[model samples]
Target: MSDRELRPLRSIRITGDGRCLFRSVAYGACLRRGKHPPSDSAQKELADELRAKVADEFVKRRGDTEWFLEGNFENYVRQMRKPHAWGGEPELFMCSHVLRMPITVYMYTSSSDGPRIIAEYGQEYGKDDPVRVLYDGYGHYDALQPSVVRTQSRL
Candidate 1:
């Protein structure tokens, strides 16, 4: 694709302090609200807050979530409430429910393919302007934003 046809995408790097997933979602939430990404301190605060809410959400919907959880549901929720606990696919799904918005996860593929959508959550909340995030295969997530490109006027 030509430069003019290609849309520039920017990824906001999230801290990998076991809270990357929450930070990424928080950053994307800000972007979705048409606001600038928060400062690092603010991102951390938001992430922790979101993490707490997600843990609570799991409890609130335990009947539906318990079966899919790998371990004892009570213990799982207890551990997930810890700030250092890493979040994975199940938490991502709970995040969607807690935020009441859809989330779209993209991953980088071969250079030729660029980035592609690997998973999506919260479709029941509607599909418009889902919070976008990039997942590095190893276990990190970053917020994605569509950059605005300005064209120069040719003489």
Candidate 2:
């Protein structure tokens, strides 16, 4: 695509703490579901609330299946609900199910293969949903803001 044809995309950085993934998902969810996108402060509040709710859902689901979660489920859920507690693949899967929406994680890398899809959960269930997230190859997550197009007339 030509330079003008391609609109530049930007990433809004999320906290690098353990809650980064959850917070990024929460921000994306709010943008998708809310009437108007909430401010950053409100987004943080929403993310905090989502963290607890997703953690609760994770704990509840543990009872239905055996050998699903490693370690004590109670402690796992407890740590998950707290801010700055690192979230991994399990939490990513649980968040997708609990939110009932797809979570597409884009992973950038230095490899010649280019960026990759690290995870795409609940997509089949919510095919029309635009909610997704971007992961910087490093240990951080960020929200991808929609790219804006500028025509010559506008320029």
Candidate 3:
């Protein structure tokens, strides 16, 4: 659908207090499961949990590729667990793979027709369900839920 047709039904804004990306992903995961996102403290806790889980999974599954990592796996995991780590494409991909959840990111900027899908990870396991994350050009992320319109009624 076009951007206009895909306006958000609701949005959960994530604070840019150094961990917006992690929080965004955490919130998106909840949305994917058809559940409400957690509060700030809870979201932070969830993000921390996700970070640790993803880090362990990465080492277990991709430890051989440690050379590609900027630092040792231990340090990588340590940084990831920090609240100021600032998750990025690598983290997003890892999270998607580890969690088996499809993630779709929409970026809104001055040079775009509208909010456009900037990144996606993971294969849809059922019903092609995907979690969505929105990135504002100014440096913040939010969970975006598309509005669903019912056009017909049962007779």
My TM-score estimates for the predictions, one after another, are 0.90, 0.78, 0.78
**In candidate 2, which residue ranges exceed 4 Å CA deviation?**
1-9, 64-68, 112-114, 150-155
What TM-score does structure 3 among the candidates reach?
A: 0.78
Give the C-alpha miss distance for residue 143 in model 1, angstroms.
1.1
Ordered list by TM-score, greatest first: 1, 3, 2
| lDDT, candidate 1, 26-121, per-residue tens | 999888888988999999999999999999999999889999998899999999999989898999999999999899898998873556779999
**Cand. 2 Cα-lDDT:** 0.70
Each model's number of backbone clashes?
A: 0, 0, 0
On TM-score, the leading prediction is 1
Q: Model 2: clashing residue pairs?
A: none
Better of 1 and 3 by lDDT: 1
Model 3: lDDT of residue 13 = 80
**Alpha carbon lDDT at 59, candidate 3:** 76
Candidate 1, TM-score vs. the true structure?
Answer: 0.90
When sorted by lDDT, best at the front, the candidate numbers are 1, 3, 2
lDDT of 1: 0.88
Alpha-carbon shift of residue 24 in model 1 (angstroms): 0.2
Superposed by TM-score, candidate 3 places the C-alpha of residue 130 at a distance from the truth, in angstroms, of 1.0
